[model samples]
Each structure stands twice: as C-alpha cells, then as structure tokens.
Target chain A: MPYQAVPCRVLSLTGGKRDNDLILPINSSLSVTLHQDQLKTTTTAAASRDFTEDRLWLNGEEADMGHPRLQACLREVQRLAHKRRGGSAEDAGPLSLSYKIHVATENNFPTAAGLASSAAGYACLVSALARLYGRDSLALQVAPETHWPELRVLVMVVSGEKKPVGSTAGMQTSVDTSPLLKHRAEVVVPERLELMMRHIRERDFEGFGQLTMRDSNQFHATCLDTFPPIFYLNDTSRHIIALAHRFNAHHGRTKVAYTFDAGPNAVIFTLADTVAEFVEVVKRSFPPATNGDPFLRGLPVGSASLPEELLAAVVMEPVPGAIRYILHTQPGPGPQLLDDPSQHLLGADGLPRCSA
Target chain B: MPYQAVPCRVLSLTGGKRDNDLILPINSSLSVTLHQDQLKTTTTAAASRDFTEDRLWLNGEEADMGHPRLQACLREVQRLAHKRRGGSAEDAGPLSLSYKIHVATENNFPTAAGLASSAAGYACLVSALARLYGRDSLALQVAPETHWPELRVLVMVVSGEKKPVGSTAGMQTSVDTSPLLKHRAEVVVPERLELMMRHIRERDFEGFGQLTMRDSNQFHATCLDTFPPIFYLNDTSRHIIALAHRFNAHHGRTKVAYTFDAGPNAVIFTLADTVAEFVEVVKRSFPPATNGDPFLRGLPVGSASLPEELLAAVVMEPVPGAIRYILHTQPGPGPQLLDDPSQHLLGADGLPRCSA
Candidate 1:
C-alpha cells in the first residue's frame, strides 16, 4: 500500500500581556515541522481515520475539538484573521479561514527527563495551526509587533500553564537586570574563546571540560555577585559541581561541567571523550531517588534548533528544561520548504481530517 | 693590574655510607675549569691563595659551609674518599684526591619567593667542579644523578631545622619502583610529556605552569594512592585547589591548576589564554597572609633544563621546590677531561687551598 502524506506548515509567535496588565514581550519563537507516518496498531481504526481527516493529534491521542485551550486558540486566531481582513467583529459565520493542519507531536526524547517537552508540544501545535491559516510566515516575520495580541495568545497557549509565567520574557528581563551584561562583551576575547571552543569540539575533554566548567562557574558567579544576588545554582547544583570537581581530581581531567537553570535539575555539559565517564560518575554519585526511575537517566545529547530570525534574539541560560533534550548540534541553516506539500499531514480537500 | 687566572680541577666523590654501609657506589670522576672571577667574592686573600695552592676548598663561612648539611655533605664526601683510597676503616688520613671547584652564587630574585635557587646553584657548582677535574666526561654523564643528592642536601640545608625531613629519596625511588619505567622503550607517543617539558624549557610559563600543575597533581595523587597512603598535600594545598577551581569556574576556561608538596607553598600553573586571568584572580583572591611575608607570593614561573646524558633516568616534577627546584636540563653526554689543568680548582699539588 502507498504511504499517505500530509500538508502542514509551522509558525512562530512572541510577546504577551500579563494578568497584571504589564506587557511581557516574547523574545523567542517556537517552530515545528509536520509529517505523516503509518498508523500505529495501538491506535483505533476510527482514530486513524480521524488522523486522515483534520490532521491533528492531541497529547499523542486522537484530537478532540472540545479541548478548552485548543478551542480558545482557534477562536482567537480566527478573530485575528477576521480583524486583519477588515471583517465585522460580530460575524460568527466561521470567519471564512481556509487551509488545514495535520499535527503529530512526539517529545523528541524521554518525557520527564527535565526536558521541556510540554513547551515544545504546545509551541508546535500553535505553529501548525497558524501555518494552516496562512499567518505563520507573516506572524513570525513581524513577531510581537504586527500582531502583538495574537502573539500573546499563541505564547499563552503554547506555554500551557495558567499564569503566563514569563517564558522567554524572564530570560530577557534577567539579561536586562544584569550589570555585568555590558561587561560580557568586553570580557569576551572571541579569538581565544573560539580557539577554546574548537578545542572543545575536537573532543579534548580534559581541556574542554576544564574550560567549560570554569566559564559556566564564572558566568553564574558573576550573576550571584550582581547587585541583587541572583542564584541560578541551588544546593543540588552545587553538589553536582562538587561531585564533578572531585571526579576530575580523582580521574585525570574529564569532560563534565554543571549548568543549572532557575530550577534544581542540572544540565551537565560534557565532551564526547569524557561523556561516558561523566555519565558513569554521575550515575554512581547522584543516582535517582528510586531504583527504577527514568527521570535521571543517561544524558540525551542533541542540538537546539531555532529559526534564523530568532537566533539573534535567543540567549541560552543555564536553562535545563528551558531547553529540551541537549542537541549535539553544529552550525546549520534554517528551515527549507519541501517541494511536496503532500509530505505534510493534510487531506485532499485541503482540510484537516479528524484523527479521533 | 692583570686579572690573574686561577687554575682549579673539579673532582666528584661518589662513595658514601649510610649508617656505615655503602649506599652510593663511586665509579666515575668529574672535573671543573674555573677562572679567578668564579671564586667566591667573600673569600679572604689568604683563603684565595690557599685555593690556588691546594686546589681544594675546605668547609668555611665564605663557602656558606655554616650550613650543617653542606658541611656534613663535604665531610662525608671527603671521608668516603679517604676510606676508599686507604682501604683502612679507622684512617681519616691525608688522602690525596685532586680536583678544583670554582663556586659563584647569586640570588637575583627574592630568596624566599620559593624559587629553586638551590637547585640552580648546586647544578652550576656541579657543572663547574666537573670542568675543573679531568673527569669531565664522567661528571657530564652522571650530572643529573650527581645533582640529585647535592640538590637534596641543599634543600635540607637551606630549609634548615631538620634531619633530612623531605629527602629526594622519596622522589627518586619512583625510578626503581614504577613498573611503567621500562615501557618507555616501546612507547611511540612522541613523548607528549617531553613536548610539555620542552615548552617549559622555552619559558613558555603559561604552558609550563598548566602542565606542571596537572602533572604534579597526578604525581602526588598517585603517591597518595600508592600502596601505603602518603599525604603530600596539606590544608593549604586543598584551599588553593578549591580557589583555583572556583576561579576557573567564574572565568572562561583558564589553564591553571595548583599543586603542592609537603610544604604549604603552592605552585600554580596556567596557560596563555588564562595566565593573565589567573594572575589577576590570584592577586585579588589571595592577598599575602602577612604584610611582608615572602611565601604565597604570586606565581613565579621557571623552566627545567634538559640534562645532557640522563634525561630518560630523571623525571622532573612540576611542583616547584616540591623537592626543591628541578634542574632546567636536557640529556647530554657523560663527563670528559678538560685540556687545561691550570684552569682547574685543584692545583698540581693536590691539596686544599680555599675554604669551601
């Protein structure tokens, strides 16, 4: 049998208003690429037909039109489309928006592994919907400006939590709050740091780990020594640091350094040469609370891909889940549209097939 | 007034007894070629004339022989010579051994800065003595080994207040004890360690210090994990390590690590990328414990010479003054005879002239 394909598009959104009426600007956007795959045996035949229909899968299950957030997002997006097309606000006649979205979302790595799978899922869903409605490219290009309120709605939906808790806004605010932020430009010797990074990329873990740990520590320490004393590193983080130091001292220099976010879970950055060594050391030293718990399993390394438009605005924190799985990434260009839209997840009538 | 040239023949005595049992087997001889300028400036006119006549310098204030270890060492050498030649156990006789030693010493840097001035001085002394004696070839051959004992003696003497508390024996024992010592024959690693040593020799301090600290840490750590536990690092050493780790964490990766021996003094090693940063951090973080105290002064860098004949036999530890300063050395040939006996520290009469 010939494999069925779907037509899908992705969009990025940014910026929003808080409940307190303070406008929180979204500095980063989320992207997702949609593709079609054979139906799994676990999925019911009706669910598979639904997938062939609306092309939407919710929470890895069949999509339901009744999901509150989905309903709210779709309504808001249609309202914005109506407004942009100079239509009357009171018209409830479907708003005449066209195109369809097929969504199949999977958290790239293990769930509950301290990776931000939730954020990615929501971001991808909203992005897919926006693309289906033909607003994705335009929305991303003008981002936070051309459609500020719509961007806010998208961000809120993607974040999925009730209170719009900062998201990328917090990162910007932190950078803005830093007195040393200005000095960061001066402290950097690009050539030297580049050489070091190259050396790191070369898998000289002894050398690379030494540098990475030092740099991260310095960066965090500077944050602490800042006027108000911001601490990204908590007790657990410090314990990890201490453990790593002891490990390096015990063994010859190995590649393992701790990077922390606003929360406690640690993101250990290590080089290929010593990654195994690091995993073993961490496994021995900081085993999970439960014997069979997979939350703190071996590190899943990968790259964090962002659109070219968003790259300059992005500032990676010691954020563990602010990032998803660590992408063992190298430099590469942004998304290139595929020639065949059939490779995406949509139906012949250019409408999403109901998966559920 | 003509600058009168003084002839001195340097001779090295090898047979030594520890607790009345022969510990050192004397097989080779050494000679030194000394000019008048090379004589100690503090030597009285009579002592100078005596040095010219006897071709030997007895222990005296001018020679800094007030140091009991230096005195004991010379006496031990003399005693062994008499015993070896006379073949009589009781005779402290008028044993005749002809050799002249020209001595010149200076302290260009601060004496208490923990520089291995003693090692340099002893090495120079040995070199000069070998030249004065007709046994230059043998002295050159065993120069590295010969310096080890004298260097040990100098450490003991200068450090004073001791019964050879920290002896070179512990350090040199590795030569006999290390199982990997024989593997040097089959190794093809381009002697990365040697390249590191060469980097040290070129006074590439940043490179040297980094390697030195790492090697020293490894060396001492190995010692601690040796069959019987040995503690080369003390509390101060731990403090230094903690601080370096902390500092490195704050900055980007700096090539600096700290290593210590039995003493409290620390040797900090850093590379070019991090040398300046390390120095600044050290200066800011570690002010002198006392106003005028010389120890714990900022890092003072030095190099090792490639000893001519026995590079393979000698392993230089990076912890400066760990066993006192290592001779900046490369491998060279063994000792040889000098053409001019007049330039020898020992005159033709073969008697002590100058007080050593």
Candidate 2:
C-alpha cells in the first residue's frame, strides 16, 4: 500500500473523516489541516532555464536534497510537469531535466513540536512550485480558509523537549515492528473510515468525536505495540483522554474528542456549542501552575457549568501547568491565494521576498 | 476456550511461566501460589451435627454463600471429599452435603493493596478444608516456600486508593468488550505460553523476562482495547516501563523486565546477579522525597553503578515517592507445615481459636 506522506499518519496511521463524509484516505491520513495563514511556512521557489542545479533551504538555512523523500517528491512533481508541457514550455523545449529550481522553506511554529509543521512546509513548497511552474491540475487543490467555520481545533501544547522523531521515520518503524498496527491498517481503518465519513455527512459531532477518539487510541495502542514502544501520550495527554471520556459519558454523549499528534499536544474536536464547555474542563483539569495562564489558546467559554457528576467522575488532581497553553483554531481552506504583495514570499524578480 | 483460571490467571489473563516450567495450567490459572508462612491467611472450619446450614464469615463478617464461584469451589471440594471413603464406616453415610460446616477466614494483608491477599486467603481455606475432610487424593498440594531460588519478585506498590475493580468483573468486561483480548486468548497466549515454558526450563533470565513483560503488555493492551477501557498503569507505571526498556537497551541486554498486575503496581523480574544494579537504577530514577525510606525491601545492593548510559537514556524527572514500598521476596516454596498447635486456626472444639 502506498504510505500516507501526510504528517498526521505519524501520530496515528488512520485519519478519520476530515472531509466530513465525502471520501476517506484508505491509508488513514486522518490529518486535521490547519489554516496556513498565521502558522504559515512560506516557500519561495524559482525555476529558470539559466539555473544549472537544484537546491533547497528550510527556515532560511540550505537543507540537503539528498534525502530520498525529497528526491522522490521532486522527481514525481517534475516528471508530471515535464509530461504536461514538453513541446511548448514558453519556447523552452522538452521540459525534462532542462530546468533547475531553487526552493526555500520556513516554519512559523517550532519544528518537531508535533504540530504537523512538516505538513505545512511540504504543502507550501508544493503550492509555491505549482505556482512557479504556472501549472494548475487536479494534483494540487486549494480552497479559501473560511470554508469550514464550525470545525474547531484546540492544541493542548505539551512539553516538546524530546528530539523530534520525523514522521515518516517513526511510521516506518511502526510498520516494521507493530502487529497491532498491521491489523488496524488492514482490518480496522476501512470500516471505521466509512463510518466516520457517514458521521461527518450527518454532521454528527458526537459520533465524529467518538470515532476520532477511538482511532487515536488505536493508533497509540499500535505505538505501544511497537517493540521498544513509543510514548506520544504523556500524563497530561492521558488526562485529556480520560477527561474527555468522563465528560462525554457524564453528558450521555461526546461533547469533546481529543487527538494527539506525534507530540504530547492534544488536538481536541468540538462543535461551537460544546467547545466552550470542553475548554472549561481542560482549564479545571490542567490548572495553570505557572504565572502565565494555562488555558493555552481557545475560545474561552466562560466558567462553564461543570456538573457535579462530571466533576466527581473525572477523579483526578490537577497537575497544574501540565499543559503549557492552548491554540484556538477552526477548520478552513487549504493553502490560500496571496492577494497582498507583502504576504508573498517571492518577489517579481523570482527571488525570496523575505531573507531566507 | 476455558479460562485457565488458576490463580495466575487471576492476576493477569496471560499467565507467565511462574512455576519454573513445571505443570503449566493451560486453562490460564496463571496464578502464582504465595507462601502461607510469610503472607498468612488463617481459616477455621467446623463440621458439627448440630449445624443446620453451611455458613461463611469473611474477616469476621458473614458473606453470602450464593455467589457461584464460591459455591462451585465449595461444591467441587465437598463432592470430592464425599466420594472418597464415603458410605463406608470411615465416612459419614452418603457424605454429600451431610456435614454442614461453619467456616471463618481472615487475611492479615490489606485486600485493596494490590497484593494478592485474596489468593493467599482462598488457598488457606482450601488447604484447611482438604485437611479437615481427610481428602488426601491429588486435591490439595503444598511444599516449602523457597522452591525456586533464582526467581525474585519486587512489588512497586501503586495507588490502591481507587475502589477495587473485582478481577472477575474486570475480566468479564474485557472478554465482552475487547476484540484484542479475544485474539490474545485464542491466538497469542498459546504460543507465548509454550515459549515461556521453554524459557523457564532453559533458566534463561533474558528470555523469561522478555516473555513476562510482553504477556503483561498484551494483557494491558487488551484492557486498553476494552470499551470505556480500564487503566491499571498510571504515569508511574508507564514511566517504569519506559525506564526498563531504556535501561535494557542501553546495557544492550535484558538485565531487567517489568510486568504490571491489574493495578498500577509493577512486578519487576530480574536475576540475582542484576537485581542490585536494577534496584539502583530504580532508586536514581525515582528518588524519594518524603522522610520515609525509598528502597522498600531488596538486597540493599548499596548504590550499584548507575551507568552513565542508563542514566542519560532514561530521560525522566524524579517523581519523588511515586511508589509506596517495594516488597522484597524470592520464589520460595508453597505453604509450609504448621507445627505448633497454637498455629492451627481451629481449636480442638472444632471452632475458631479467635473470638471472631
């Protein structure tokens, strides 16, 4: 099976219905694509007949193009472009191995924070290159950021002190070592993906939440199943899971569902109706011990009515400041169009607008 | 398939090779018989012509005789005792249900402490009853406690503060809800059990330790697989697991292996040669902050060399005094012979010697 190059597969091989019921990726790329405007990785790419060689840079520093994944991406994309306009490339004959490109990438968030920064980086590169090549095809698609206003993502930023284990490398190790993962990918994902799609179509937050939580759990289970296991969910992340269950079960339905990426940070899914209350539970469960606030980032629904039942059932002492902060976000479009010149990473001169 | 439900299965569904490869109860009685001398449970039984009905008092409180498991144990033993020499001059006429017995049982250990206190209690009752009925057939067996000299078990006492989830109930829930558990019992256990037996016979510490740890992990994995899953391992327990792997990997051998019971307490298995060093690692990883002693009970292998590699590899801050005290014990013989008359729970009057 073709592996999901998307970064969400790092945390869990299965990606629940983010398309919200249309179609699910069979390999389980249950990734929550964040809005790239604020946490943008601006990649500047220029392809010229004059260029002699290909080069790349990440966050202003030149990065090696020797990695096989990079080579594969470059090869596949260039191959497609060459095939499309071989004879007429603005008087540039047969586009194969003729043009050289320089790529520059940057990240607004910390690399390896398990925030899917790689996802953003690769996406920006793909977008910028697509624009640079001046080619528009089904291979690259983007929508406006305000497409899905109801869907929200709250990132419970955890301590990202450990060295980042790259997504694909971690996934490769899991595939090699984990039997549970094999069963999940082969047996569990297909059925769950279908169900998740249906639930998404119905806009059933409760069903969606449950599917999200279970798939995330199964993913973590596979991680644990890996020999010499990997632990992405720490005490804080575990508490979030427990709290979500307790809160949902107490309410007789899922008000919140949490998904952990490769890092300890939790991406919680909740409708606007319940997001505020879920945030309250988060704050109460993980009180800010630090002088700075612990609520992290989220649309703070004021002191939510934490029911006696939920309060009693969650049964855990707050490990103050376990969660650093929260990042509030809503699902929107993919990579957006740059209307403002200042927002463009590349100038008309075909060089990076910003120092990279 | 019938549950191997000997006491070993009572602790974990996947029974480890506890008896040094002797008779493995394939039915999953993965039970480790505790020595009655050190961990004692006293029971008194009286069979009188005057008693109208069989009654039981547990820890001085009357317990219902209607529970099926309890009734099954009583009925099976009684039927066996009655079959032997019954209807003859040596036995009462027809023997079956002819004698109404009053039984009183007591355990010195705390039941909720995650120690197998109930196992010790039930074994004592069964032994006393077997002796009382004069049933010498292969119905009951006991030997010295120190049978296996090389084996050692250290209990990392965890928080038993939560209400105890009964083992049978927990097992039933797991069986009902966990598909992974079904796969484990039907597929994983048989193969692993054979390997465990082989490992034990070979007296291979590394092999034995690896099997124990894997079985424990699978069992817990099944628990996680359960719907509304049960969590026996807390942060402390998970930390211990990570530490064990890091320690083993750093040393490039399985010097120590950790297994968890139904609760958070970790049962670490290590050979005598490495116990001292493993203990030191445990000490350094989990330093005590309370005025109380940290090394509960073990060969005070006085600060064995905590290798720089292991120390650096297991990246964790000391969660001061996470574990209660550790119980130091080696694989000893079974129940010992009680020679003193005062040691007998029952008096010459066929009644409990104590006031209860």
Candidate 3:
C-alpha cells in the first residue's frame, strides 16, 4: 500500500481567540496567525510498502522524528480518521493505506529565530495534510483563511548573535513558578480575551490595537515574573515599543499596535494607509547602518519625517543597526489548496519531486 | 538650636520582609543598615532668631524645605516630643526655643544613582533631628545600627545617560495596575518574609542569600507586570546578576546575594571572605575598559580567573563599560554623631560654613 503526500506552506493571517479552551490555559488567549507570502515550510508525507518508520526534515535538513508533541498530534489525528471511516486500512479495500509516513518540511523563515516561526509552518502542514487525507485536523479548530479581510502583520526582525532559549520551555517554567503568571491565567486573561473578541467582532481597530498591546504586555510580564526571570525584548525591542506608543500618542489615537513574542522581533499591526508613515518613523529612529541588508520588504516606501511631535513623545534613544531587516506583509488567507500539479512537492513515486 | 545633618548612604544591606504587618505590610523585613565609609550626605542646621525661615541645601546647593514627606516626618516627630513633655514650647520656653532652622547637606555618591539614595538621606535627617530635638524617629522603628555588625553593603555603580523614573513612583503604578503585585503583597510576601526572618535569626547566610535574590526578582517582576512596564534593570544590571548567580552555583552554595533597588545599581552582600572571589568574577565578566574610572574601591581584589564551570553557567554575555565604578564597603552602622564641632556645615553665624 502507498500513502498520499500533500505539500503545505504558511498559514494564519489574522489571529483567532481561544476563550473556553481550558485544556492547557486557565483562561482564554487571542493570537493573530501570521501569513508570510514567501516564508513557508513544504511538508510532504507518504507511506509505502517498503517504508519502515516516520522521517522528518526541517529547513531541508533531517530532524529528529521522535518529538513528543509531533507524535501526539500524529497519533490523535490517525485515531480520529480511523474512527470516522469506521474500518481498518486493510479491510477498507482501497479506502486507505496503512504504510508508515515520511514527511519533509523545508522552512524559509530560519532567520526569524526564537519567535515561533515553527508555529505557522506546522499549522500549514497539519491543515494541508488533513484536507489531502479527507480528515479533520485533530490539533486545532480554526476558521477559514478568508474569514478576516483587513488584518496585516509586519515582522521587524532584530539581529542578535545568540539564540534565545525556546519560549515554550520558558513559559512552562513561568507557569510552574511565577505567581504573576498564575494570577494572569486565573484572573486577567479571561476578561481580556472577551474584550479582544468584541473588538474583533466590531472591526474596531482602536480597541483591537489597544487590547493587542496590553495582552502582549501581560504575556511578557509573566515571562519576567518567572524565577531567574526570562527577558525576550532587548534594548532595540524596547525602542520599537516606545516608537509605536509615541506614534499613537502623537496621533491622539491608535494608528499602530506593536507586539513582541519570545524574541526581540516586533510584530506591528497597522492599516495600509498608515504603514508608510509608521515605517518612516522606524527608519529615522533606528536607521540601518551603511552597507546593511535591505531593511524593508513588500510595499515600497520613501523617506518621511519622524515629526518633532512624535519624536518628543518617545522615551528611548533608538540604537541604529539593531535591526537587520523588516518583512513588510499584509493580512491574507490561511493555508489554501494549490491547484497546479507543478507546485506540489510529491512525485508519481510518492517521494519528494524536488530533492531535499 | 541647630539641627545636625548626618550623612546618609546605602540603605539596603539587610532587607526587610513584609509579613503579618497588614497595616502597611504584615511581614517583618530585615535590612542591614549601610555605612558607606565615603558615601555620606552631610546636613548641618542651626536655629536662631536672626534666621527668618527654614532653609536646606543638597550637594552644596539650596533645596526646597517644603517637600510634603519632609514636612510630615518633621511634624510627627516634633508632636511626639511635645506630647512626652506634656507642655507647649512657650510653657517650658527654654526646653524648646522657637527658632527657624537653616540646614546644609551634601552627597558624594553621584554614580550610585538609582537605588533609593534619598531613602538613606531622609533616614539620616530624621534620626539626626530626633537626637538634636530629643525625640524618637517617626519614620522607621528599627534596632540600633549596632544590631547587625557582620553585614556589609557594596554598591556597584552602573552609569546611564537617563535616570530611571523613581522607584517609589514605579511601585505605586504597579500596585494600582499589576495583579501580580497584589498577589505578592497579599499571598506571597507574607510567607517569604517569615523565611527571611528565620534565616536572619539563624544567621543562615545561604538561606538569606537565596531569599534575597528571589525577593528582588519578584519585585522587578511586578515592575514588568505594570502597564507601560517599568524597566529599571538595564543590560548592565542583568550582567551583574548573572555574574553573582553563576559564581554562587559554581561554589555549590549561596555565598553571595544581590538585590537591586529602584535603579540599576547592585547592592551585593557576601561574607567578608567571599567578596574577593565574587569581585574577581565581576571584573572578568565585565572587564574595565582601558584607563577608565577606578574599577573598584575599598577592598583590593587582584586579578582572577573566570573558571570554566562558572563561565559555562552564565547565560548573558558580559557587557563592558556599562558600569562606572564599584564602591566597596562593609556593613557598618546607621547615622552617627560627628563629635567634632569643626565638622559642622553650619558656622557660628548661623549660616553654612562653606558659604553655600
């Protein structure tokens, strides 16, 4: 028997809120899924008569196949699919194949280290494979990619030589030891999630942006509360936060909102109309050094002033060359089916068409 | 009558814990009163009919005498002294001469910027005035300075261009907004204070050291949890913390403890024996730039190696020139009387001797 392989890329554009999911979190949390136009991980899974075990690749390089979470996800999905069909693969007579799977995923967002790049990559892999195999994804229930129309996400990648400790591990430590994290989970996050969902429902950008920034603040505060506390934002990230807030203060409204994850990189949300101005402020405040890499992508922008009004509000003195580049992108669809056979990674033989 | 202004310096060699003291804090906090041999704020005050009003000086310059906290402290102590005599200033006229007082004060620790320098300064003022006017201090009730003879406080002065927003103001914001601070004040500090007091009673240096570091971490965590987030610990303070922790882990015990006040300066505590090695670790981890200011004062610590074990434990890469200098001193005593009249800042003419 041979197994089907599906290739998938980036997923998540506008984040979804998880409110009644108490399995892991004590309260609800909202997160905007990111959609990187060019950054993706192509996952190809196939089972063959000769295949002996599951195999995995990350960034075109083989990675350990025994990761606990991956195994758990795989096991749950297969069990659910088996129940849905209500028959064993052997007895189903062409309904399915039970060969071992070999998955190859190549990532293009390697430079976005410690900022949960794998999250979007894995989301794409699961959703695409579920569609190919005619089964529901066992990991998460999410809305269609087209659900949100106006959201945009820009990732400001700050360069640092040392890799940060994985945020997943850090969060676990905080959960176990930080009293602040406990209070936030039990008391604060539930109400915040409600307010965020309300802003989302009403399409109130101001309310959404304010809630987004505050939620990010609470998350990082939990990180800081951890014993032998964890620090994700560097001086550069602090400068970016100040710049965003000061810009908003200057406008007397929320024109832009900024959030930082496990690393110093900032995810800024703004409208298409305001992106150019905000980007201009970033350039002037933390200018790229001469002979540095390209600092902006997606929409083309020109020089603009960081007006005295905005500059006066910023408390931090920006440090130049702290950021390596900025990936400019807009809100778009989640994972989608590719109609062109040329775009598929799997070949007629059920192996990868392009050699990893 | 002339008020004597005693010099005040480092305030946190011993820490106080808040337990059952719910009026302010239900818990008992142990603090080692710091006696900086050179870091002093001298204040000399004289009361005379010729002097029309109260005046004060700070660092050789005139300072406002009508600060709310100062007035409140002064009024309460004067009231307490009056009640004990059970007579008005007019009834026992010689007991209390009605005269406006003039005062002068100075500080030598400029680089020792943020850690609530004004606390020790004000503490000295209250205690000196209490002695001069024959009253008890209304601010803090504590054992005499002679209570903790073995304690020492070393203030490592880290330099920065901008001063942090005062810690007092930072804490108030945290209290009003940070849920973590509420949890700490109500649930966490009570227990932790008991442990700290026990450690103090038993003279358990290791226990005290661990608790000290943890308490500081909790305080800063609450700071981070505050809205708009207060960041007092810079890259330099972080480096110092890592140096201290890594050194302790290497020695397989807590030989030294570190705490940060509202600012970046590190208040380090260690037995007199461990100071040399700990200072060695600090110097190597954060090497002095060539021909920079004196790296350390007080005890002379020669060059030493950063052992492989200790270096392997530190997570932060050392940042150089972030610190200005280290003021080395052991825990001595609180404010003391300068017996020599020649040391007074106020001269016979009821004006500052140095003509401030």
Give me the TM-scores of chain B across the candidates. 0.42, 0.80, 0.85
lDDT of 1 at A33: 21
Task: Kindly list the per-residue Cα lDDT of model 2 for residues A1-356, writing each as its tens digit.
Answer: 00011222232344222222222332654455565433456666666776677877676676797766666667666666666666455635333345777776667666777777776666566666555555553432222335345777777787535633554556666666665666667677777777876676677787877777767776666666666666666667767777778787878887777887676777887777777777777778878666755454434454568777777777467767777777776654555555566655545654565663
Query: What does candidate 1's lDDT look like per residue over B219-324, in tens digits?
Result: 4432322211233444334445545655544444434555444333454434434443444344333332343434322223233343333222222122222222
Decoy 2 TM-score against native: 0.81
Write one digit per residue (lDDT tens) for candidate 1, span A131-189: 44445433332211222111110000001112212233443443454333323323332
Query: How is the predicted docking of candidate 3 categorized under the CAPRI scheme?
Result: medium
User: Measured by TM-score, how close is model 1 to the native structure?
Assistant: 0.28
Which parts of model 1 have CA positions greater than 4 angstroms off?
A: A1-169, A185-193, A222-229, A271-277, A291-356, B1-356
Native interface contact recovery, all models: 0.00, 0.20, 0.52
Best by TM-score: 3
**By the lDDT metric, which is better: model 2 or model 3?**
3
Please provide, for model 3 over A233-348, each residue's C-alpha lDDT reduced to its tens digit, 9 standing for 90 to 100.
Answer: 77677678767877888798999887776677788888767777788778777778787467887556556666676666653566788877777765554455656666666565
Candidate 2 lDDT score at position A344: 51
For every model in order, what is the number of clashing pairs?
A: 89, 22, 26
- Interface RMSD values, listed in order for every candidate: 16.3, 1.8, 1.6
Model 3, residue B208: distance off in Å is 1.6
Better of 2 and 3 by DockQ: 3
